[model samples]
Target chain A: MSAKPPASIDALIELLAKLPGLGPRSARRAVLHLVARRSQLLHPLAEAMTEVAATARECLNCGNIATGDLCPICLDDRRATGQICVVEDVADLWAMERGGAFGGRYHVLGGTLSALDAVGPEDLGLPRLADRIETEQVTEVILALGATVDGQTTAHYISDMLDGRTRVTSLAKGVPVGGELDYLDDGTIAAALAARTRL
Target chain B: MSAKPPASIDALIELLAKLPGLGPRSARRAVLHLVARRSQLLHPLAEAMTEVAATARECLNCGNIATGDLCPICLDDRRATGQICVVEDVADLWAMERGGAFGGRYHVLGGTLSALDAVGPEDLGLPRLADRIETEQVTEVILALGATVDGQTTAHYISDMLDGRTRVTSLAKGVPVGGELDYLDDGTIAAALAARTRL
Candidate 1:
């Protein structure tokens, strides 16, 4: 609006605009929606935010978000399968969890080693990962990082770093589970063909 | 994640997903962002939301949101131009304010008369609007509702109801200020030609 809204409402809109996928226009709409449905949406959301702000914390063991020192997965005794899946971020770890196939624990690297950004292995908890292999009796490590150059570089570096200590494996290079061959990119098609499996 | 997050965090994401533009995926991303930047974004946002949730209220006179009984526009002596702008929702009022064109007070209808939804004049505060026209000594009433059929029907209903009480006006129909002629629909082209003004 040409006229600025009340200070509190304006502040809410500005903060909402900073969210990842929401811009100024959508943020304004969101603010209006919240204001219109105050009891049902806005007030409850505010309470939830306050609660989460006070309690949410990062897991000390694997970098996953938790309400306590260690994440739930790391705390579970049954999940101590002598294997660790390494990912670039907590979001990636969550994606892997959604697949429901991995029985081992996860190590969130926080980010990949970015040469341009000056991010190194140390910045991504690689050192901590090494410590976990021995401490947690990990016998295998799965690299579930992206297919980007940095991801590959990070994977190779970790493999070399842990050489002769544990079995290192990676997600297969193939078409996605529900992917149609015609819709795939050239690199994906080539990779799928190169890594074709026997029936 | 396969494992549920802490209850508070899960609740926050669910509430965020109910917003206008955000879906479950984006809500998760937004929550992750807030958690990652707790001090900078999350805490401040939560505080702002709490403040707005406590103070924000509907204007008794015009149905616009305000922190007090009367909205800022209704309280301002400078905006007493004896002209009232009628809009379907508070969002439209804010949009008009952003344009900085109108100099009169606003009357938010909250919604239009929707027969399918069993909405009627009283449902949209039309009676209160009529009372305001007489009490505020309004000279002109501008209908700035949408171009949809319901919006037009609402505008016509209001105009007829106030036929003798005040002068009535609708926004002009023409190509938008910067709109290209070729890209416009045929109806818009016809309206623009029919309402053409002398150069």
Candidate 2:
């Protein structure tokens, strides 16, 4: 009731509260937790944050976050240059990487084109994709973007852009691997039926 | 996933995942968010952590977290020395302070006496509390400890220890404000009934 917290402690709470899911209450709890274990958590967290702040940067080639100008995927020469998988965000890229199936590189679009937000082809780095296809000799471009209206519109635009040059393919729309037929949505069941493969 | 995150990035995620409420998945999302907003969030947070790491420490007298040897409460001379409020932890002290009802000094016990965990009066600074009662000429000692078994056990021990020196009062048990009688446990309903006052 008497003396307020140190100014820096309040500032720390404010910054933490700005994170994706944390609010003021959770931020205070986290700050208290960190202070209670200063040596174990506070010190290491500070060092780690300083390290990331100084080194983290967007990859020059594909917009993925990396310490260097090139992200890990962009730096890996072993990955196939003939195929490029496109996704709407770096989280999508990380998810595809976790699957460990595709051996190709990725192109992070940052976000889909939204007229309301004024995002356009240039913002999505469409010209960069065009240049990459020619320079990397990419024969196939895989669209791993979501099935939203914006995603479908972007996929169609990309397909038309590379109509005569390289093959463009979108991921199949069907019931998920463990999806139950009874739980499947109408659109999903209809799409699965249209694209059904014979056993 | 293809090329694992840089060492610093992975370490940052691991450290964040260790926080009370955050999990590995949420940690990843938070790290990504911080990295994406390095200038706005990462740098300031790092600076704030470094500041707290260097300055945060426990009050030698009261065991409350403080920047100096004495906590703010101890430093403020206007507070009444006639009463002392004892709490189980710093978080509890903060909660009391937020309530703004107490104008007396505080003594943080760190924890309660627990025979199972081998904790005793010495561990909770009971000796120091006895010294404070005599030194500060305290007339009343308030026990704001929770209603848990350990809390009650500790309260009884303190009440007996200060039997002749000063008045010791534990917080009254009753149904919480805004709590519905229908939703309250039998014990809380009973306590509320027993503590009932004239309207």
Candidate 3:
């Protein structure tokens, strides 16, 4: 029992463990599952990863991930709605897409303006955002950043930088669509109450 | 936003979501992380998966996953200790290996007998177990099956079948190590009390 598994299997487990939600134990289980169903899962996953590794790239325009220079959102001609939804990372962009409410394009900031981590506006593609407003004729900049302190700070910085260029708005604060008042924290409840609208 | 990502990226997400612990949302995150860090994580993982897919196979003798016809445990002469640890699945075999306690080889039954699923001894390689006892001169057969009804039933059936051929034993039933008495369930507490020793 002291003998370890094969090197490839061990390496796969190590890499799988580094994924966001999977720890070492579950990674090992996942690797085992993949190995057991090789033709069905492991082979397809390997092939898919190889293909992505060869083709996946960040959009040169908006920093969204795609297989080409411009992401699908950035390349779509019909997405010219004169509105650019700004987000902290590609994950946020995907989240916004999942909501299926935004009909415009996106500007991925890559990260927030964090003074502690030394992340500045330049690092977040603020210059590119301003350029996009002029070149793409954007009339609105929707700040879909998180509710965190850094997120707010970043939003404020972007808004001030684009004060005269375009309208700057933010995603509204309220109890989530399916969330309950009982489960919400004090700050959320307060914000939701303050922003309450008439029926 | 209506435009889908490239076919490869979508395929990767779909395959990843089918893994043991990952769902659609987390799969997207995992795929994004892989694509973003292609050189660091994605390429290596893809290579490892390809290697494992090409080499990994079930041991013809004991059903453990291996690179060849027989698993490493079966091939190692040191593991010929005239004892066989029987388990319901390869996961249990790996768990036992992680403990580094067992000194003998293992026999993965693939799954426990289930009346509802129409599983039987033949399906679990019971005949091979009997043959191995005679050919390998196995003096002990340890049943390391789960505590479920099907697991227990399978264990009892195996024990009865090998009544006089070899000494049959089961994993000890008691409170797990590092477990608190107050948090233990009624069945575990009762079992611990019944199996209490002079220590």
Write down the lDDT of every candidate, Cα atoms only.
Answer: 0.92, 0.90, 0.90
Collision count for each candidate, in order: 3, 1, 0
What does the lDDT come to for candidate 2?
0.90
Candidate 1 — which pairs collide? A1-B98, A2-B97, A2-B98
Residue B142 miss distance in model 2 (angstroms): 0.9
Q: Taking the tens digit of each residue's C-alpha lDDT, what string does model 2 give over B1-199?
A: 3667788999999999998789999999999999888898899999998999999988988888888898788888887668899999988888888888888888999889999999999999999999999889999999999889999999999999999999999788987788888898998888888999889
CAPRI grade of model 3: medium
Residues A1-199 of candidate 1 have per-residue lDDT tens digits of 2456888998999999999999999999999999999999999999999988998888999999999898899888889999999998888888888888888899999888889999998888889999998999999999998999999999999999999989999989889989999999999999999998889
Candidate 1 chain A least-lDDT 10 residues: A1-10
The best candidate by lDDT is: 1
Ranking by lDDT: 1, 3, 2
Task: For candidate 1, write residues B65-114 as lDDT tens digits.
Answer: 89999989999988989999999998899889989999999899998999
- Ranking the candidates on DockQ from highest down gives 2, 1, 3
Candidates ranked by TM-score: 1, 2, 3
Candidate 2, residue B58: lDDT: 86
Give the distance in Å from residue B93's predicted Cα in candidate 2 to where it truly belongs: 1.6
Q: Worst 10-residue stretch by lDDT in candidate 3 chain A?
A: A1-10
Give lDDT tens digits, candidate 3, residues A21-132. Answer: 8999999899889977889999888888888888898999999888888888887888999999999888888778877888999998888998899998788889989999
- Return the TM-score for each candidate structure: 0.96, 0.95, 0.92
Interface RMSD list for the candidates = 2.0, 1.4, 1.6
* Candidate 3 residue-wise lDDT at B125: 98
Spell out the clash pairs found in candidate 2. A1-B97
